[model samples]
Target: MFYMSSGNDIPIDPDGSSSPIPDIDLSSILGNTLLIGIAIVVIAAPVVGFMAWEPVEEGNVKVVKKWGAASGTVFEPGAHFINPVSQSTVSLSTRPQAYTMSSQQGDGNRENTDDAITVLTEDGLRVDIDITIRYRVDSAEAVNFYKNYRGTDAAEQRLIRPSIRSVLRTEAGRLPVTEIYTGEGQTKLKAAAQETLQQDFNEDGLILETVQIRNVNLPQEYAQSVEQKEITKQRKQQKENELEVEKLEADRKRIEAEGQAEANRILSESLDQNVLTEKYIEKLNETDTVYIPVGGEGYPQFVRNIEGGSGQNSGQNTAQSTNSGSTNQSAA
Candidate 1:
């Protein structure tokens, strides 16, 4: 009743050999171990590759795609996982970018170049203008903008500049020449230009910052004429001012003269004729003697013969006596 340790004494083995009940191969175990290690490496390569990638930076977003087709969902900045074989991401900046373009000088050989734009005034005068536009990209919409308008170098060259230029020219064309130069007018024009640009560019995914007019170049002849006209106007105004001053002075002098004449007239009217006669007699008597003119004399004869009373009416008496002597001379 003894049992064999291997299949040696088993009924199933045709020849009794000193072997265990089940055969185990050390080479097969090692081969299986090697296959498992190879399988682990094959699976880990893609996992490691996926783990190593990072998404777009902060303040930016990644445009995710599957097999080159957009997923329509944006991925924010961080470490992220994507389909290793089919999905990908493209990052775009979400920051604002300012653009500045200055006008190029025309042929420098000419002394007087027509570096002017002809703008029409409301009064139909043609004026020259110089201006600048300052603008920036909108960060919130730059991601979409990069994908669409700035898709490639060709798009930027062919589309963006032309659009901006067209919009600017259209706005400038609508403004009058005078409005572009004056202070309040320039302010209004700038506001209108900014609004027009914002409306036009915003639809095309652009943001506008500001538009400024740097200079307005009127023709030299026109400027000189305006100055001369201003000078003439000032001179005329000065002459009118002088005339007004003279008129006021004349009126003042006339008023003073009239006032003095009225006072003199009132005094003359208030006096009695008898009082004037008495004043005349008193002045005559103040001469202290009298001269009588005789017809046969070479000169008037002097006489001091007022030998009447030295009474209170002496002045009146002298006048009367002179009159009586004149009557006697006439009678003789």
Candidate 2:
């Protein structure tokens, strides 16, 4: 028997008849190899691309570092092509974050603890303060923030929390315990603390949004003392108000009396002798009887008609005689 080699046209036999074996086609094998290679590449291309691409979500930025050094480029929210073997990306959230320290539970981003801050006031009294700070990595300076703290989460632990504690301690120390317990003074302290912390955060490439003093715990004895003082003060104010009301009443009464006296004085000054005589005559004309004072100033000497009897005849005679006497007196 004869057998043909697949690589060449030579025929060889080990046993049996001489029948030619078909030569194997090298082109087909090569074509099949090329197709397999192409298929492998097609499958592996996506895998390589998937490994090299980095996706940055919204509200976040990715900092790419190449060869252990920053590439000085930040990728915004989109698909970014990067060399996975030689370069890597660090994704950081540019959104606002909160760091809260309080005795009560807070939102998910808070550090709830019973360990309130104890600070000595300027007057040497102790005060416990619970505070919350809202902050964020400056989006424009996210790379710098990353360089300083190496990460956004790290910025909170290393930069924000410690700075807040330090600023709070310093600002609280400047105020008296009495003032610290008051609303106005607490507001001032919060402002001062916020300013200080903002400055500190700015230095570390972070933005300080707000600083809130959640609660302030005062000594029991001091709180009671303040309560008593407030009670006494309110009582004193009440008494003062009552006295003011009384004073106003007295002033009103005095003014009314003075007005009445002035009215009486003016009336008295206006009534003269002639005015009185005219008033008396006007009253005499309204009745059938007349009375005359005998010997007083501004009074007639006698009364002629004294009764309601039929004095018409006598009255006419007397009136005629009186008319003649009045005419003679006028002529004289």
Candidate 3:
């Protein structure tokens, strides 16, 4: 039999002198275990929470890939529980970006000294083309883009770079290299390149904003030849301008001569025989001899000075005079 001892802290059993189990605080032990479990739960809650949810930032989307999930799985910008045990998230940016290929290092997206594209023109000239591409992932087609390239970086290297190179080469082969050297031709080339590359971009779920030809470098001899050709063209234009001025001067001289000849013809047509006889009588006292018109010609008539005998040579002058050419005088 178990019996109570003198104090409540100890008890006696029939087979043993004392029993320590009877003196143990059972209520306290139970209470301590419950508190310890509560503490463990409180400590582990935050850690589990962190592992369960992902935060997506602005301008970014998360692609959650799970075993049973379709390839089109996506998550927008926000905190979302993705079940850390089974699903994974890849953050992708949708902002526009640019890729510059250039011949000089540090001037382009590439680190190489000469990352410019080397292409052959239809005219069989080699040129280095520096181009830039502005692009972005199509948000609606992000899944397809990711599936095709796995990431934006891969898309730039494999699709963007290669497509630009291929399209530029194709366009360069369609025309002479001299055409590409002109502003309008460069514009045309850029348009064709952008158009062709845009098709490639669209098929691959990428958006091509712009394609720019930053620079084009021809071989040294070709560059010199182009410069000389431009000089020749300028010279030809100058010569044409000079010839135009000369033509205008010749027209002015021709007009002046025509006006003078027209005035002389009008004067000759206005004069008559009556006006000629009056003019000859008005000048009779000023001359020793006069020309009188008989038919279409003139005959000289001498004027004798009776008061002074001043006109001494009038007779000699009349003897020598014959049919002169002055028809403006009448009988005087």
Candidate 4:
């Protein structure tokens, strides 16, 4: 066996054999190790810093913090420097985003689950309302939003959804189920809900663009009932319209009858004895035979008769006589 001494020198064999060990300088080893370490750090620092760089995308902002304390600096869309050892950046989008709550799978902001909002009306009915809300973080208030909510998901989960639900519940509770299902009432509800959400979002550093109630899910039984009620209401309205038309028709007939009666009254009032006598004479000329009544004992006695070729002349004479008699009677 060969053993080497601590003092760099020769190796001594146990069987009296000897060999020389290579001379190595400790200072050179230490210096070389230090140089390599410095080179590695110089090369790695930029790479690490580059890797730590946070990008604030378009329509977004990044909140930078140092040592877990907000640095009070918000970075706009661009590459920003951050200390890898003591700083971090949280990116928040400022673009308008839509969040939908729906029972169906494909229609909402979240596609993985059913997030429909359920509320109770004044009539104690459960209504599932699918709504889409468009909103965004106010760019000016991004820091405040970051400090308070940290991220969009947190804000949506804690603030937006809850506020929407609260407002909807309160507003919906004020309306009966029937009213909620009606067109005018539903429009009012949507407007009210949007107004309430707008106020809430304004206070929370968010801009609410729109609130749309996409669908309403009523209980099966209630839906059927509503349908039946709607049908009945339409039928009643139709009947009322028919009655109104009938009333108008009756009024028109009454007006026409009144006008005809007035016309007849005027005609009758214009008919004096002279006019009646003229009309009687005109009728007499149309007849070739003349019958004159001579007695008034409930029996008519024919006094004179005229016919044939001299009928027209006789009729004309009779008319003149009749006219003279009517005039005398009037004078009397």
The number of the candidate with the highest TM-score is 2
lDDT of 2 by residue, 151-232 (tens): 8678777876677677778888888887887888779778987888778887877888888888888888988898899999
* Pairs in steric clash, model 3: none
Q: Candidate 4 at 81: error in angstroms?
A: 9.7
lDDT, candidates in the order shown: 0.59, 0.76, 0.77, 0.79
Full-model lDDT, candidate 3: 0.77
Worst 10 residues of 1 by lDDT: 295-304
Write model 3 residue lDDT over 1-332, tens digit each, in one string.
Answer: 66664756566667767746646899999999999999999998888888887998888887777764534778787779877777777777888889889999888887867899998999889999888888887877777777788787898888888878888888888879878777876787799888887888888878889888888898999899988988999999999999999999999999999999999999888876556555676785577566454322222322232112324365454344342323224443
Give RMSD (Å) of candidate 2 vs. truth. Answer: 8.3
* Ordered list by lDDT, greatest first: 4, 3, 2, 1
Question: What shift in Å separates residue 263 of candidate 3 from its native position after superposition?
Answer: 14
lDDT of 4 by residue, 246-314 (tens): 999999999999999999999999987567655655776565554445334322222122222335555
Per-residue CA lDDT of candidate 1, range 206-294, in tens?
56666765556656887787679789999999999999999999999999999999999999997775665456556654554434442
TM-score for all predictions? 0.44, 0.68, 0.63, 0.57
Better model by lDDT: candidate 2 vs candidate 4:
4
Cα error of candidate 2 at position 186, Å: 3.0
